[model samples]
Target: MPSSFSSQMLSSGGLGLAAGLSLIVAIGVQNAFVLRQGIRQEHVGAVVAVCAVSDAVLITAGIAGLGAVVEQADGVLRWLTWFGAAFLIGYGLLAVRRALRPSAGLEAERAATTTSVAAAVSTALALTWLNPHVYLDTVVLLGSIGNGEGPSGRWWFAGGAVLASLLWFTILGYGARLLAGFMSRPSSWRILDGLVALVMLTLGVLLLVRG
Candidate 1:
């Protein structure tokens, strides 16, 4: 490819990366779940892979014009919003229970039987797919923006988005281990679970209210 074309692709990819991260690097259920798994160090790889791969697929689909199809499905998203909200609220309550119970803290988490890989993967998928914002942000917003970058630029932008997803999840899922030592205390885990509970419940209620 010509140097000019190469430069354009690079620019597009950088733009895509920034945009993708902007939408992703926020306090969300997906990030919270991934972080929790990372701290537990159970099936961390599977969770990260599911999240990254899911993002790539969604981003690609959005840019490929499936976003238009999604745009026409307002009713479906509303239903999903209800379901997602219910799930988040339920999960948040579980987190609340975990926080309230000292036995459920990270200090004793190691002795607890880890969840199956299939269960982890399933939860990851639900967290990714259930959120209506995922479709609107990853598909509709990113799709429109990436598609506007022209044909070649669109794919380059998509590559950047996929890269961002991989990079962020890898960092978040693994980097959280650095805190494993500090979080070894039961109180710390309690606090973490409490925060998770707050996030989940807040997001859940907001989803329902917005819907």
Candidate 2:
């Protein structure tokens, strides 16, 4: 291919990546949990990689036809919304409590237990699959958007989204521990937990009302 063609392709990839990433940047329970995992340096690589791959699969499915299928399942969507709402609210309350009544020091002094790859994979799958918003974003919104791009852009868009998820997970998981070191203050964790709680509660309420 020509130099100009190569540059154009690269530019297209960048655009696709950005679009895919934008869809998932919202503050949600899944992300909050991932961030916590990242901070703790527990199965960071596996977690990130799983999340990324899950996104790619969903995005591809959405492009393939899952969006239409989901759209047709109105009742299922409502049920999912309710369940997700409950999870969010409950999670938020716990987070708020932790923030307000923080432990004097690290709650548990313990060696890091080894997490098997299987367990890591299961956790990632649960986080991705159980979260209704993942379907809403990946299958519904992203699918619609990717379909709009037509067949040619479909692959590019999917590739970009996959790459974005991969990049985000890798960076977040690996870099979280480094940040934890800097944010050794209990106050920092409190603030973070508090913010996550607020976001989750708000989102949950919104979803409930919307449903």
Candidate 3:
């Protein structure tokens, strides 16, 4: 009985971890922000914490029945979708401005650091909360899968999923620092910011269309 239960738990948790990673590994707006912060070594800890904690809350909320609520509350999501679309587009525009502006790599990063911690934190919060896609992914999809683990393994699955979020954000946020050396060039910043702008704009337009 013990061995069977252990196997079940491990299998369920492992699957959750894999699923969570798969969903998060993509280059999205949120990840782009985290990577930019990480590469700049500016407010990385705060950014990573915000992302991990937000994921945890969203994933847990989904498991706790918010997924069902979201499914029924179409109006709520619609508002969020519009709000998110606007925010993303605005952020993308800012990225475009940065990309077009010439910068000396480290000099630009230093300038960015002058942006108060409060500003960085605010940006992180907005990027995390304003995105409706996060809800559909974490709350609806991930939550549904975690709950599908059956009552016995559901919590275990959630644990794994939550762990995955922590691990992913931690790595992405911190791992970006590895590229700090390469990103020291002005051209690198322009290229990265350009890609970020493209991603944010595309996603924002898609959200508006979907809404």
Candidate 1 stretches with Cα past 4 Å from truth are 104-107
lDDT values, one for every candidate: 0.92, 0.75, 0.89
Candidate number with the higher TM-score (2 or 3):
3
TM-score of each: 0.96, 0.82, 0.96
The whole-model C-alpha lDDT of candidate 3 against the native structure comes to 0.89
Better of 1 and 3 by lDDT: 1
In model 2, the clashing pairs are none
Error (Å) of candidate 3 at residue 110 is: 2.2
- RMSD of model 2 against the true structure: 3.1
Tens-digit lDDT track of model 2 for 145-179: 77776666666777787788787777767777777
Candidate 2 accuracy as TM-score: 0.82
Native-referenced Cα lDDT, model 2: 0.75
| Deviation from native of the Cα of residue 89 in model 1, angstroms | 0.7
In TM-score terms, candidate 1 sits at: 0.96
| RMSD values, in order shown | 1.3, 3.1, 1.2
